[model samples]
Target chain A: MGDQLIFTYIVDGDDFTRAGEASSSVKNKLKMLGVDSDVIRKVAIAMYEGEINMVIHADGGTITVSVSDDDITMVLSDSGPGIPDIEKAMQEGYSTAKEEVRSLGFGAGMGLPNMKRFTDEMNIDTVIGQGTTITMKVYL
Target chain B: MTIGEIQRVLDAQFLYGEELSDLDADFVFSADMMSDVLAYGEKCSILMTGLCNSQVVRTAEMLDIVCIIFVRGKMPDANMLSLAMSKGIAILATKHFMFTACGILYEHGLRGGA
Candidate 1:
């Protein structure tokens, strides 16, 4: 409200069930702050997809969300196996998730695209054998 | 149609949020993949899925889907039920398969919107 409201979360990669916890919390907070429903929906969906990716691919990570007057920004960082090809990964049906993840109703290769679709700005930074960090923003 | 009517049409048993059954909805979206639901599921009031997990409830929460219908009589675990309860999203379990459940709701005038 004043400067920028910052919320951070540690995504547990081992527990798939708890993946969306941070996104849900942020969504509720945004609602309490009287953010527009459409904006809240965008943030929630993008953040939730990032959360799922963290669990399914990255094996855990950190998510930092900052809400400002102009827009809401989400930064998700993970130290997992970095993506090999950002272009291929961005494809709507390109996925490297395992079969087990598919059983959970995800790994449909729509995570990154969906994230990009719902957010106004999205950037993915990855280094092989290092990690990956995704930054997404949805204008308020 | 209201959630109560859908329940009656499908002979669904409420796993949670039966009090919210009186809530009305006209659009239905059925999917086993949460990604598909998130991608094209806007304005959909009810989500019908055979996938029973906490993410299903979370997906519904993100989409503002008021109710989830689990086909093939699949039941949600305690964690999912608790999550849905806190989110005020209703849960229903029906014995019909995905196609059957969707058809029944479609026949009852619940159309899937574009």
Candidate 2:
């Protein structure tokens, strides 16, 4: 809580190529702050996947990362169409990304699975018509 | 194997990070999909792909991948190269196909991610 760094980002939906900028920025800041390399990597990978999901699926979102002594906590909230089936989406090699997204070297059906792989904990909150929120944490 | 050796085996052009050509790497994974790379690649490795974009470089940065070799003679745009320089990740280019590039590196002792 006290003296912990709380970084927030608003991911822009329009620019597909710019999707990972926020995650990259956070990675650099964490490096400067001297977080452990392994912890930094896990956090970066999870954040990157979530950011890409925001761009490709959510149409945009806000991510808040709170860095403290014990763990790195991330909360990602998006306003796009919510996932109809969380279980299906959680399956590896399952994706709904369009062909164009696949052409861009993504939409590989690996995003959610990879996020789950890197984080110590994950939670999904969604509404059919509204949006979804994902909370993840990686213990440092 | 050093990145320079991987470049030589693939007949690659060191588009950036010539200073790091001597940096060592032990393996590679060829995929345009950053997700796959993130899920598969390991430390002291290189990523070979035809995808030309800033995210590729950013992904390499996040993974701490020492080198990225763009195959099929593709060149990343200015933004990507700039980001690569900022991140200190080596960038290379070659006319070899992804399969061929991975093979060459494997021929030179670099294997796929375990």
Q: Which candidate is the best by DockQ?
A: 1
> Which residue pairs collide, candidate 1?
none
Candidate 2 docking band: high
Q: Ten consecutive residues with minimal summed lDDT in candidate 2 chain A?
A: A1-10
lDDT (Cα, tens digit) per residue for candidate 2, span A1-140: 45889999999989988888989989989899988889889999999999999999988999999998888999999998998999999998999999999888888998989899999999999998899999999998
True contacts kept of 1: 0.84
Backbone clashes per model, in order? 0, 0
- How many angstroms is residue A78 displaced in model 1 relative to the true structure, after the best TM-score fit? 0.6
Candidate RMSDs in order: 0.8, 1.3
Which 10 consecutive residues of model 1 chain B have the lowest summed lDDT? B105-114
Q: What TM-score does each of the candidates earn? A: 0.98, 0.96
Cα lDDT tens digits, model 1, A1-140, are: 77999999999999998889999999999999999999999999999999999999888999999999999999999999999999999999999999999999999999999999999999999998889999999998
lDDT of 2: 0.88
Model 1 residue A56 CA deviation in Å: 0.7
